[model samples]
Target chain A: MEVKKERSNNICTLYVDGVLDYSTMEPFVEKVRSIEEGIEKVIVDFTDLEFIDSTGIGAIINLVHEANTKQFEVELCGIIDEIKDLFETIGVFQIMEALQEESD
Target chain B: MCSREFINEQPREINKTLEREIKLARNIQMKLLNGKQPYLENGEVLGVSIPARVIGGDYYDFYVLPDGKLRIVIGDVMGKGIPAAMLMILTRGAFRSAAESTHGPGETLTAMNNAMYNDLRTLGSFVTVFCADWDPKNNTLTYANAGHNIPLTVTSEEDIAEFPKTKGVMIGGLPDQEYSEESLELDDRGFVLFYTDGIVEAQNKDGEMYRMERLCDVLLKSYQSNVKDIKESIVQSLNIFTEGVPQRDDITMVLLKSR
Candidate 1:
């Protein structure tokens, strides 16, 4: 799994690529978790994530909860339709924004 | 004049016909679970085991011997579809192959795990399996649960008792992990069910689940262990639960009953 970070102005963006499964999720989780201290807004881009197992889904859910605790609004951008459906089915959309495109 | 030639031709034709028939039978047998009944052994009942494609990714096929012994298997592949089916068939072949020598539940799981780990993981896949040797003659069901969903044994009161996961990893992940072994009683007329997460994770229009708790509730309601009724109730509830909802995932389950 690959996680790339970009910061512009106040918004912090993360690009997640590759499979987010138990084996690969370890490092992915650490990268997302590390940004909790500084970012005011966390935008995750899933345009690159190929597959995600339950554990990976759990990590996303954990990130959502973490963002809530940290009071940072998290928005997901550039999600492919298939992975979007996965998050929707698991009720992740209810907690975070599932963006098809980014206007900014 | 034609007798010698006609007689010689009959044997070859018969051999070819036999080969064709065997091939046909194999094709029919492969579809043993072609979206039909006799396949749905368990109705809306408690603790159902829906064995998918007798040779698919999920396999749990068991029967009793004339001397009154029960055998059970629950295996999941590291991949889905045809490749999983091939591995399942290989396991079946190995079962019949080492049936005499492969008697213990623990040993069977270990043997299967070792053979597949290197090759299956090579394809970025691994299987979590639970193979059991249920000796009805002694009312004992010994099994080893791989990295699969924990099997739940329910009672007439809608209470659930989870069986332990013994010596098993995701079957092919680590070479040195120890697989634990455990056993349980089958004295009563209750049923033990096995299934893939597909069944429980299946969602309806509202995103509600045909979860384990709800499934157990259905089984407890019938209080009758007839495989047909129980299977029907579960499927019926599933249909109701997922009303107007397309299948989100492949739902597979299997059930075992003792008389």
Candidate 2:
């Protein structure tokens, strides 16, 4: 998975791309945790991510858990429907805010 | 479930018609196991689920053995879908007969595994099985896990006991595999719960697992309640847990209570 970081004003943005599976969980979480302390709300863009397996799903879980414990608001935006469905099934959308529109 | 019906009309192509019916049957297939077994009274519930799918990959049968043993069997076929289901059916027959004749949980699984392995391997299929009996009289249970989930026992003592450890290859993976028995002596009024990996692997909305820790918490919480109630509570908790996250895996669990 590829994560791009952008900061403007008070918002920190992450643009994620590629497969997010078991092998990619550590890097994925570390990247988010690394910058979490400096940000108010972390917005992750999943528009470019293709597939996610079990471990990848676990990483996402870790992200939310960390975000909650650390008291930082996290939102996922620009996600494709396939990945979105995966997110929906796990019920992550209920707890985490979704960025409703595509950012193309 | 949005169901479309073509009522009062025979299908055009029988082959296509049969296929459609099978798919529909699968979608609507649900188990309503409402009866007392072993320690349970008139309204007690004891059940086990082994999917013929990724989560339900086995032809599961829960019935009374001729000698009055509370028999439960869960066996997964080598692969997924219809072919595996067919193989599960075959594997199931051998199990029931052996369970009846030999009357040993370990033997039943071993025999079925051996009998079906070559044929299953030929078809590129394998089966993982767990079979057992609940003895309410002594407040005890005996089981054999053949490459299946370790069944957990919630005793009246409330000391949670997992099915004992045994080293055995998954069915269909090896031609000659030996399985050993694991026994649990229950406190009065206890039950055994078994399930597929699907439950632990399920995810919540945050992409976190509705993992083993969470599932164990539920089991511990609901041990004293009725099986159906426990199942309902679990499903509800899972639904709420994911909030709006979609199900990535099938969910199945079987609870057998010993009074």
Candidate 3:
């Protein structure tokens, strides 16, 4: 997977492209966790993301936990329908919702 | 000073030893995962896991609870290869222990998460588990999920598919995770299929995914077959769909059908 970062006024948006499977999860996790310290809000854009599997889903959940621990506001943007259905099916959306509420 | 021949033989010997150890590990994994099938009074439950490698991260198990209910669980640990296989064993231990003390599937998952969450966090990994209890007397199947895919239920009388709803995060995703339980009555000759993501996500040479729609179609066609036959059908369909494309992930499934 390829990650591109855009920042403005303490808000950082990360655009992800390509498939996020087992091989790409490590670097993806590292990149998500490496968001700049000054950022107050984090957004993950999945418009260009083609595919993701269970391990990839786990990495996203891990990112949510990290967002919780680090007290950063996080939002998932431009998720493809299939991946969104997957996240919904496996209840990842619930975790995101719950953690986001906690942060709020 | 070691001779050249001796040095050459050392690497070969180490390769032999490594191959032997991997074979041993594969044997252990097979024995544990392919243990005895559980029989319900009027129902049958069968489970199988096919690793992409000699061993894989996919897991499924059945436990005959003291009260006569069958406790079933299927899980996929993060990643693949040897480390994933090791964690699959760890997941098995946690499931077995939790199934004993926990009252229901939800409780079992909660206990499992409580037991393994810290270790998973430390290792930067996680697992998705779906647990169920089949009560033959009541003809009710109660289940809970920890971020695993929802199993599809196909009835012989109807062509439609049903996905039992569940709500929970993956094991180790949160420190303290609570799972919710849902139950449904099992109809005779109907099939309840629990599977890992591998089957649905299996890709063909054309880069086309097998997809859930195709799986549903296959299940609808095979709903009348015996449990073993249904499993065979799934594997056959997957093989045809992939058509020489190598497997990318471990495939596992447990099919429960009432006679």
Candidate 4:
């Protein structure tokens, strides 16, 4: 997957494009780690993401786990139907939703 | 000039030995992967794993618990080729060791995760697995998953398929991970298809993926066939879909049909 980062004030948003699989997870993890410290909100935009596998889901879970440990907010937006179904099946959104509720 | 010839001959001898050992390793792996199938009076279990290379990381095995329950596991180690193959052997060892002492699929997975977590983390890799215990007499299949794709169940009469929903993180991702088991009763003439991602993520020449929907379609069309025939149908469909493009990952499947 190709990740483009945009920063404004203290918030950082990642725009991910292309297929995210086992081969692409290292670069994706690096992109997530590259965000500067003290960023309040971390947004992952999946508008251009076409395909993702279990390994890709694992990377997202790692990102969510990082957000939890580091005390930051993570928002996932623009998920396509298939990805949404996959996230739901794997209970990714449930964990994210629980985190959001905990933060609130 | 004589010394140079001797040096070249020594290198060639080493190369020949290395190639011979690799071939031997491949044979060992194939034998392990295609081990004896368990006999279930009311059911039939068949598994096929095709490595993209001579030997690959995808693995599946069947073990018969003392109580006569069949324990089956299918896993995909991260990446492919030699490094992944070595880890695949490690994973198989862990599973066999754990299955001997564990009570259920969940416990077996927990044991495997505990055993392999350190090694996998040190190697910067992970494995996804789907474990199931089939009780043929009871006609129930209880399963637990480690971030693997949910297996699809298809009936001979229905034109659609459904996936069993079970959840857990990938093995080796976190230490002390707990996997929960779910049970489903099988229809008399139905089958459950457990597969690795390579089957669905297979890409065509135009970069279009074969995908899950198409796989479901193939399964639905072949639901009336025997388990072996069903597997052949899926393989044929995949070939047609990819249009002879080189395989990128290992394709593996385990099917259990209620007889």
Interface Cα RMSD in Å, per prediction: 10.9, 13.8, 1.7, 3.7
lDDT of 4 by residue, B55-156 (tens): 899999999999888999999987777787898999999999999999999999999999998897676577888899998788888889887778888866
Give Cα distance to truth, residue A77, candidate 3, Å. Answer: 0.4
Model no. 2, DockQ = 0.02
- Kindly indicate the candidate among 1 and 3 with the higher DockQ: 3
Q: After superposition, how far is residue B13 of candidate 1 from its true place, in Å?
A: 30
- Local accuracy by lDDT, each model: 0.61, 0.62, 0.87, 0.84
Number of clashing pairs per prediction, in order: 23, 26, 0, 0
lDDT of 3 by residue, B1-259 (tens): 3355456677778688679889999999999999989767878889999998899999999989999999999999988879999999999999999988999999999999999999998877889999999988877889999988888888763565656678788888776888989998887668799999889888999889898888888888887798999999899999989998999999999999877
lDDT (tens digit, per residue) of candidate 2 on B1-259: 2124345435675556767767764553333222233444422545544342432344566666665567677654533455545665677677766776766787777777777777764654455577777665665567776666676777643467677665454555444556677777764566667776567766776667787677777777887887877777777777778775766544557777654
Ranking by TM-score: 3, 4, 2, 1
What is candidate 3's TM-score against the reference?
A: 0.92
Q: Pairing residues by index, what is the TM-score of model 1?
A: 0.59
Q: Pick the candidate with the highest DockQ.
A: 3
How would you encode candidate 2's per-residue C-alpha lDDT over A1-104 as one tens digit per residue? 78778887667887778867545656676777677465667788888886665446545545654566566667778887856744553334533442122111
Q: Give the Cα-based TM-score of candidate 4 against the true structure.
A: 0.83
Instruction: Report the lDDT tens digits of candidate 1 across residue range A52-86.
Output: 75556656656765666677777878888866754
DockQ of each two-chain model: 0.04, 0.02, 0.62, 0.23
Local error of candidate 3 at residue B134 (angstroms): 0.8
Please give me the DockQ of candidate 1 compared with the native complex: 0.04
